[model samples]
Target: MAALQIRQDYSAPDLRQRAARERDTRASLRLLAIANALEGMPRAEAAGLAGIKCQALHDAIQRFNAEGPDGLHDRHRSGRPEQLSPGQQAALKAHILHGPEPERDGVSAWHLVDLCEYVERTYGDSEWGLSGPLKRLNLSRQKTRPSHSNGHPAAQAAFKKGAAVTAAEPRGTAS
Candidate 1:
């Protein structure tokens, strides 16, 4: 197979330096390394230097030639679309800010399941979970700390005030 000629616009050392300074993803660095190796070496050797297969080296070269340095970076991909519209999101945020009341909403606190039901009933059918909405709204659920069942509030306050309370068995007797 005929060896593909690499463009001589930049030297291998220059490419290597640029690759070192590249702040993007690791794939870009690998592409730069491959481009540098291809400057003088054969496809197989260049691929080895870049720790990629020959096919990948060929693809990288084509990308580099067509789009220059920018082509070496990762391509943007569109992920799953959001279920809630802008207005719906705004409404949800407003509802969350209003908070829940025991007499009105019939709950002391808003739970994930309760929020999910509320969204489904109020906004429409939404598969969106609580976590995503909570993150987007920058809201967090308040949690209550566990307290001892037998703890006495008045006795605790007295202890804090330096009240001298004697032990049940007294300090001197072991029995």
Candidate 2:
């Protein structure tokens, strides 16, 4: 196989300077490797000094030749596609924010299990699949503590006032 040639436009010193200024460790390594290659070091030795494989150095060289210094940096990777469409996600977000209808949803508040089931029934997706979308939407699994149905604010305030009064009153010594 023919040895890949390092671009002559960028000198070894220039590449070293760029490597020193680079924040990304991987990109810096690639720059260093190219610099070593530019200085007449063998491909395998150059890649080893950069803590990378010869193949990686070759790939970096190709990128550098094609796009110059900018090409040495990693390409933006588009990860796995979203399961739900934008409209569907928006609907889900709105549904979550508006809250579950007690009559229709049969729940006073939303829970992960409940939401999972709702997603399955409404979107035809599995119950397990809602977690990732919910996370992406920044919806937390944690729910607010439920208030007691029988609790009265007035009664609780009165009890607290009475307790405070009792606590403030000094106890008399036994005769």
Candidate 3:
């Protein structure tokens, strides 16, 4: 394979400064050492001391040479877009706090499906399906039912007592 030619723009001061205060300070220092050795010392020796392959060292050195400071930061990667805006999110939070409880709607409690449907229908927007609305809004069931049964002592006593006590049995024969 042909050896890659790279120019390192990192001056000694820059390498030292970056190496000193970074979160990954040691790694940065090692990278700087590799860069220094590549720029001043030797490629093989620098890459070996830095514990990295020559190709990786070459790439780092190239990046340092081109972008300067900002190259060290992670590149921006796009994420999923919002189903609703920040204002919508804040409004939804308010709705969760003091909006009419689900019980008022003849439902026992709020289920995931119910909440999703409510948001879609409330805004008169039919495009959003269950998942979109669900991701945008969250609701849970209310577990307010008492976990007990009442026992009636009067009924129990009535069942135990009767009016047949006056009718006594005949005495048994005795000597």
Candidate 4:
């Protein structure tokens, strides 16, 4: 197969300058590879100098030919789509912020597992995990310590006061 030609009008020095100015490391490497190629360096040597494969240099050459220096930069990639719609996400966020109802949700506070189950039951999204969604909604996993239902606040305060008084009392010295 014939080697792909770099149609961009930049000289070896001009390409090096562009590489120097490029903020993206990958793009700069591509630029350097093209510059070395323009300077009559072997394809393997050029790619090695740029720390990329010969095939990568070939691809870069094709991109340079088609779209000039701008094409050397990586294109924006749209990753995996969200499982829930914007409205559903908003509803989930609101539900989290409002907190769980003890009588209805069967819990005093919202836990990650409970929230995951809630999403599965309410939103019919069994695959959804609460961790990432909660993070995106600015919700943290921290919860206040649980208090015992039968604990007496007054008695506890009295006990603390008695302990403090006993601790402060001085002992008699032995003669």
What are the per-residue Cα lDDT tens digits for candidate 2 across 1-175? 7898777999999999999999998999999999999999999999999999999999999999999988887778998788678898899899999998999999989988898888889988775766788888998888787789999998778778445554444578554
Model 1 lDDT, residue 22, Cα: 82
What candidate 2 gets wrong by more than 4 Å, as runs, is: 147-175
Residues 1-175, candidate 3, lDDT per residue (tens digit)? 6555544455666666776766764457455655556466677667777676666677666666676644644456887666667776667657655545646654555555665666676665443444544345563344356533675766556556662345456689453
Q: Please give the RMSD to the true structure for each candidate, in Å.
A: 5.5, 4.4, 12.6, 5.4
Q: Give me the runs in candidate 3 sitting further than 4 Å from their true place.
A: 1-9, 12-17, 25-30, 33-37, 40-48, 52-59, 75-78, 101-113, 120-175
Backbone clash pairs for candidate 3 read: none
Q: Give the Cα error of residue 40 in candidate 2, in Å.
A: 1.8
Best by lDDT: 2
Candidate numbers sorted by TM-score from highest down = 2, 4, 1, 3
What are the per-model numbers of colliding residue pairs? 0, 0, 0, 0
Q: Answer with 1 or 2, whichever has the higher TM-score.
A: 2
Runs in model 1 deviating more than 4 A are 1-8, 23-33, 75-78, 101-106, 143-175
Q: Report the lDDT tens digits of candidate 1 across residue range 56-173.
A: 7787777777776667887889877777887887888788778887887778778878888888888677655678767877877665677899999987788785687776986888
- Give residue 31's lDDT in candidate 2 (0 to 100): 96
lDDT of 3: 0.59
